[model samples]
Target: MPPPNALQLLQSIFGYEQFRGRQADIVSHVANGGDALVLMPTGGGKSLCYQIPALMRDGCAVVVSPLIALMQDQVEGLHQLGIDAAFLNSTQTLDETRDVERRFMSGSLKLLYVAPERLLTPRFMGLMESGPVSLFAIDEAHCVSQWGHDFRPEYIGLSVLHERFPTVPRIALTATADALTRAEIVKRLALENAAEFVSSFDRPNIRYRIVEKDNARKQLLDFIEREHDGDVGIVYCLSRKRVEDTAQFLCDNGITALPYHAGLSSDVRARNQTRFLREDGIVMVATIAFGMGIDKPDVRFVAHIDLPKSLEGYYQETGRAGRDGLPSNAWLAYGLNDVMQLKEMIENGQAPEAQKQVERQKLSAMLGLAETVACRRQTILAYFGETSAPCGNCDNCLSPPKTWDATEAARKALSCVFRTGQRFGAGHIIDVLLGKRTDKVEMHLHDQVSTFGIGKDMPEAAWRSVLRQLLAGGYLQTEPEFGGLQLTDLARPLLRGELSVQLRGLPEKKRERAERGQKRSAASLDIAPADDALWQALRSKRRALADAQAVPAYLIFSDATLKAMLDAKPATLAEMAHISGVGAQKLERYGLEFLDVLHAS
Candidate 1:
């Protein structure tokens, strides 16, 4: 069989017709003993770059994944494809671990998934010495960088893989990495000479929307009721308590919602996560702890109740939705409070001053995106060093917001901060500006200050907006000790009337167009309405098979494959082999049954 080339293995085993983007080049490069560092987006078929190489190589490929759940999921998916895969992690018993080790030594498995901590152990190192290892695949390679959002200390020790087995090819893959993180990955992974494959970071299918937070819970409810009813989505909150509260709120209002956070019991979290992945129309309300290894392809929306800490975190979190290449949404509600809270956290954290500075810059970029009146998609991609035309699907492109020359207003807000002795936070400052002669203001004698009541022309929200923009734009700074707002060096220009500031006004709520290319009509996909029953029956059958095997339904056949089968209406097993995702093994195993369903329909 000429040793089964990369494309051939991709089609015959994985059942995909062709490699996506640079997947073929990556597979062949690694298969031929070339190192690679791949910076591809989520849902960009990153797994195939290494999975195909694992099949084409001589020995089992070892994948270092961060989470045990991720390993189990990938192993189950591989098993359904009739591939021999296994993992060694704490979840397995001692005997089970030893058995996987034996299989790896004997070359019985094509791929072996391990955690970084376990892979660096003495026992595993000994097993590596006894085997003819194929290559090393470092998944989520961004974890190696200290500056990355999901940094793991254990990942720092993985560079020994290259030091020990210099001949074995290594491939590092990450879904999100800025310029700094990419350089750090190359240095830490010892892949300085590896072929760098940087794919497009744009997820055009996701319509980005950032709304001003007002009656936040009501606003979230309105968004869900309007666009994402009865669809699978993820709502991200900043804290565990918020996750629980949001989940309860959603369930109370008749939405199927579940909470996932580090505070929950392991059993409860696992159960909730399993229910979310296996079932349909489940909205997982989670903190940042969740969604790292989730492979669900049908998430319709990702909503943020509060602002994320950085652009990288925001990008990664929002990337979880629309993995099926369908039109989805990334909606966020942020306001001055979000900025204040995040600044407080970062300022008080124990990280070194240098790291804090970097975080401030990243947060500032994220805030800029939130306040941008231009295309949200362009702003996101520009942050990642990619350029794109304005995507008309985003909120700003669909309905642009108005901007006002708030230079005078900004000066007034900064003066309020300065005149208040730089001791009071934004709330008190806003009160003084709005001419509120409250007890706190009177007690502090802020009402008697020259800046007090001078800003009565602008509304309270508008003033807050101006203050937040000043902070984000580096014209003001927050004191973590007392949550006080102070002027920064950058504010000198604006304070001295040397620089002008412009603030974006909140956009009026507009009727959003129906999400484009979200759901393909049966007729459009070549499946007649009369055949809908049969198509659903096929899905039901696949689900039953998956449940019987205790695996994800996608492992049996992805939604794309089922759609292809529905559209093609193959009459026999031989004809089914021509489907995009139908490999020889799948065709032989269940193709006849699918053909039978089509014939009956």
Candidate 2:
């Protein structure tokens, strides 16, 4: 037969029926000696774009990955497909490195994954000079941009690839990047001439929800108990201390939770990550330090006890869940504290004024997202410059938020901030607005002010909501020095009687939203009870097989595939081959075993 083409290799080795979205075009471009910059979402099969091209091209593809764990995972996955793959990282012994180096130089390996740090080493560059490189695949290419959430200085040195291997095709790929970050990646990586492939940023399988923070831990527990029990998920915290405490609390509540952060020993973090990937139903409680380039595909949900720093970070983190295309959740509990803390970080950090301004803008966008009552999906997509209609599955669309004419309330709050010399934060401003004769108010002698008691009619929460909306709506701004509120120029129009503000009211009662969430979560996550036993049996078999092979279970077959097996009731090898993930190699390896299980069922 003619040398196997990209499509032939894709079906024979990877087992997917067809390319998704721009995969084919991307694979063809790179295989034909063209450079590319691919911006696809997580779980969008970015690996196939390069892997297929590598097999179709002349030599081993040098995949510059960031994480050692990710490199090992990808190598193992390719090995499972019976493809020649290996990774060279710190985790490898000198002998192991030598072996992979030998394989690469001999052209026996189709793909070689190396960390960016390692790839930049003179030693590794010398190795690359010794052989023909089919292409250079830079995964998480957004990390090259300082503006990206996960910036790495090592990624900046990657431009050397273009300088040295000028003739070799190059592909830079990232799951998350806004317009600014995209341009930065192109400039930084010297990919000005690469073909650009931007896929849809939407992840419709995820049900997005943002709730106001109130007893956030209790609310998180309720969500866990109701919807995500016995399922793998991630609970993101804003601080290392919170990660530790939350993981302990979950464990105390009889949930399997692990803490991951930069503070932990590398050994502990690695063990936890290995367990999370290899086992099912592990809830990883971590700060922003975790969940980059993770390959697990069955994570049922991603919950945030604290607000994420940016929309890009939020999207990338939550994209970790429901990678198998099953219904999953992107849930968050945000409040004014999250806003204040994030703003304080941005302002107080040592970054230059322009970078800080960009960060503040990003955070402001995130706050608007938190406070938005419209479709959460629409807001996120719009931030990415993609327009989308309301997705009825989100919290806002499912249970619409209440709104009130807060124009007068907003004016009162703004007047309070101004009359207080704009030096007071929301709490004192609320106290002043509510006419509370506290020591601070009395000390400041603010009871004599014109706007002091003008807003006593509204409840304290409602007043806080109004102030929050004022801040979120740009009618008010925060002074980072004292965490106080000030009026922005946008407030000028409102103060001048040229504008009116209408704010979203509180969501439905906690009990009501929780009840509705319970129904929705059940419908989203649960399989048919009649097939539950078979599903469990198949999972157990997968787990057993994974343990024997010492690989993650999902690499054997995702939960979605097992669930499909339960539903399809495939009875023979040929029938098993018809499943979505069962490529020829996989079917030849595990098809008979799964068919036997189905027959037993």
Candidate 3:
């Protein structure tokens, strides 16, 4: 009998009937010993491009990954398909590693996931030389780019795969990479000759929402209680202490939450991550250190309490939500303080001037995205070099933000910064602008300055809005030493009355938005009230099976798969096999159990 083709294997093993986008072409090219560099968005089926090829090719395909948790998760999910997949990481004992090595040497393993650090080791290289290797898959290929947000030093050494295994066809894949990062990945990985596939970076399932920070923690709580109360989500904070405090706050407010950050013990981090993956309705509060390679499919939201460092980081993080292509949210509460803190962090860091310049540019782009009154999705896609029509899914598109002509207010704000010797922060500048006679004002004698108290008509909040827009629009910058507001060269035109400014107005009361959010909550799941009971029953079955197998619930079957089952209402094992995710292996393992539930319901 002939070897199974990609489509056959995809159906029989993975249970998907069709390849998405360029997956089929990529798989065919890689299977035929051609190199490929694939840039697909997260949840875009990038895995099948290499995974199906791995099965069709001659020997075990070696996948180089950065995170051990990612390797473990993928390997476990592959095992559910009855594929002989294993990972070698620090978490394994010597004997366990030896066993996996033996399996690889015997050509019994279809895919072997190894960290770049381990894969580059002399011992592992020797083992690879002794075995018949199929292909090389460098996942998260953008990490090789020094300019990328999630740079891994070890990934820089991955070019050795091409140098050493000259004949082995290799594939590099990433979910997020702009043109510069893409070029860097090609250069660093020696993949210049590889066939490149660039997919659209739009995630239509995610509703992008950015709110001005006002009692941010309370706003976050309100968002959760109103729109996502029993949902699994990830909340990102900029500080470890904030992660801990936010997790505790959520728990105190009756949400199931956990904290994950570098400060946590290894065991604690692992346990929390495991819980997050295996259980439902877990809100993981974490810093940027927490979520690089998480593969959970049912995360309904990704909330950021503070601004991310760059637009690339924001895109990658927000892409984590709605992985199953369901309606989800990418919500952020941004404020002027976030801008100051991030600016100070960049300027005060030990990085080279060139790198700091790049960081500044990236931060400015992120701020523009946050402060944009146009379609948020369009702005994001444009940043990645893709033109998109205004997606009516973002908050700005759904409910347009109000803007005001702030040219005069901006000039006043800039004048205050200048009059204060450009050495005062936003607070002192605002104080001086509001004509407040506090001790600092008396001590500095700013009350005597020409610009001090020049305009008490504008509220303090409005002054904050003007200053923030000034900074975001390159009219002002912060000093590295003391975070004092200073004028950038771009401020010249605006300060000289040569340029006008229109700033986003303070958001009105959120009651109407809250009502829309409630509607969105209902739409996110979209199961009819009559089908809700059966949906819960199917989820319970999946949970039970996952707990028994000690793997994530999604590994058993994704929420998408369960929803398919609920819709199809398959009656028998044979009928259950017809469901989208019910591959041959899963049919044999779980078809009858799910069929039983469906029949009972």
Candidate 4:
């Protein structure tokens, strides 16, 4: 039943025993010059949606990717499968780019990777005219939608590919896209006629957990100390400052940590990034700036110290974990401030009110996912408009969450917010709950309120839970400038006793969870540790180097590089220079220090 050339190329290059899922059908449709819109999850082999078609077609397929590193990885992956491929980016040298262009001019190149901006160039347009573009693969095609999580101004230029080359088969691919984004991708790419394929969004291998925000630093430490110790992963923070501080604190506490962000020079970003990719047992702390195009396969876990911009953003960032098909953890902690911060940002941005409102709704849904008692996998999948039964793999399914009766506690917590005119934070509210009469509470005469001492039966911990649930439920909204709470229309109903508020089930102590032990093992170190202590010494050296440079530690060689060095035990700077990320500049600058550390250890 397989069509001409489709069956041949699939086995020749992919070597798969059989096409997984609807891959064969999609490939067959596109091989016949049909357009495609694919929604496969990470590691679902989405690349084949366009790859097989490129192999069977007449001219080179142009793959538009957002990240330079990702383009390299995809091109490398294609070449590993014995397919001829090349990428054009800032990383490629003049001669290298010229040579790749040489292949394209000869009609010998099967695939070419290009950034959206580069593809829209007059020079690139002329190149397209010279050689036929049999297929166009738009990777992360959601970026073209202004409403999508990772919008790029460059992607708006992609509309031209179809406008100019009306006959070339185009396949737009993304790991995550909601219904709105899906529609936008179609309109933006002019793929209205494109065949649609949406794979299940369920990441069955990941367990999702959201803890209440109090003692967040301690709680995070406690969780990682027990379950994810010495694992190479990513910790996401809300701000550049937090990213830097958390990375430093983790280093001080005996964990190998590095900071990454856009503020740092690109050289440092690339150096740290290379370490993360090529090294093992290294943890990188970053803001939203870090996840796109990251290709590390065994990221054991992803922890967020603050909320993301949207559920789509959160899912894509967390998807970076468990890409190697192993069990991994996705943990986060947030409270009322995260809500106010997100809301305030939207309210203050320049976009149309409709876009801001849409963003707000998306963020609220994400908060619901964090607080919901339903299966995390089901909740996340539903957000993407895909329905699934309980996965029995996430924290929710394994725990089968149980709720508590907090009716009296809810009223008291609301009472404090109501009496104080919603003008204080959690600490002040906690004081009134236990009748502590703290300086701020007494200063405001909140100690005399009848709500005071009424909440004594409930532990301060329980009051904290009640307040978070109420905020997430929309019963309360934080006033950013006033730095306090204000009752929403939702709260008036609850306050007048017109509505009864029900709280979701709470998480157990981190250790009580079934996945309490580490999901990562040493074999994940693709480069076996010739010397275990070498990584530790390399980290120590990185800290000193970062301090001396007044840059984030990751600006030095990353945990990935140190691991790669340890694995290969390269004895010279020349060999280290051959690594993917290190260039002549870094090899000359930091190479000796790392080599000395490796040798000394």
Question: Considering every candidate listed, which one attains the maximal TM-score?
Answer: 3
List ranges where model 1 is wrong by over 4 Å: 510-538, 596-601
The parts of candidate 3 lying over 4 Å away from their true place are 510-519
Model 2: CA > 4 A from native: 514-523
How displaced is residue 229 in candidate 2, in Å?
0.9
lDDT of 2 by residue, 1-601 (tens): 4557777777777776788999999998999999999998988888888999899888899998889977888899988888899999988889999999999999999999998999989999999999878899999999999999999999999999999999999999999999999999999999999889999999989989888888888888888887877989999999999999999988999999999999999999999999999888899999988998898999988999999899999999999998888888888998777776777788778999999988988888888899998999999999998988898878788788888888778878888889989888889988988889999999999998999888889888787677777777778777879778888889878877898777899665885666565556443646788887888889888888899999999999997888778888988887888788888889988888888888888
Per-residue lDDT of model 4, residues 322-342, tens digit only:
775566788898875677677
> Compared with the true structure, what per-residue lDDT tens digits does model 1 show for residues 1-601?
4556887888788787788888988988999999999988888889989988898889999999998866887888777678899998988888998899889988999999999999999888888978978999999999999999999999999999988899999999999999999999999999999999999998878878888888777778877877777778899999999999999999999999999999999889888888887776899999988998788887888999999998999999999887767677888998888998899999999999999999988899999999888999999999999999998778788767788898899888888899999978889999999999999999999989999899888888787888878877878888889779988898888889998977887554433334323322210234468878987799888888778877767677776688888878888787799887788888887888788778877
Instruction: Give model 3's TM-score versus the native structure.
Output: 0.98
Top candidate on lDDT is 3
Candidate 1 positional error at 41, Å = 0.5
- Pairs of residues clashing in candidate 4: 275-560, 275-561, 279-560
Roughly what TM-score does model 2 have, to 2 decimal places? Answer: 0.97
- Cα error, residue 523 of model 3, in Å, equals 5.1
How does model 1 score by TM-score? 0.94
TM-score of each: 0.94, 0.97, 0.98, 0.83
After TM-score superposition, what is the CA distance of residue 150 in candidate 3 from its true location, in Å?
0.7
Worst 10 residues of 3 by lDDT: 514-523
Per lDDT, what order, best first? 3, 2, 1, 4
- Model 1 alpha-carbon miss at residue 55, Å: 0.6
Candidate 3 local lDDT, 1-601, one digit each (tens): 6557999999889898898899999999999999999999988988889999899988899998888877888999999999999999998999999999999999999999999999999999999999979999999898998899999999999989889999999999999998889999999999989999998899999989998888888889988888888999999999999999999999999999999999999899989998998899999999988878788999999999999999999999999998998888999998889999999999999999999998999999999999999999999999999999999778888778889988888888898899889998999999998899999998999999988897798988888888888899888999989899999998878889998988898877784466465546543778989999999999999999999988899999988899999988987887777788789999999998988899898
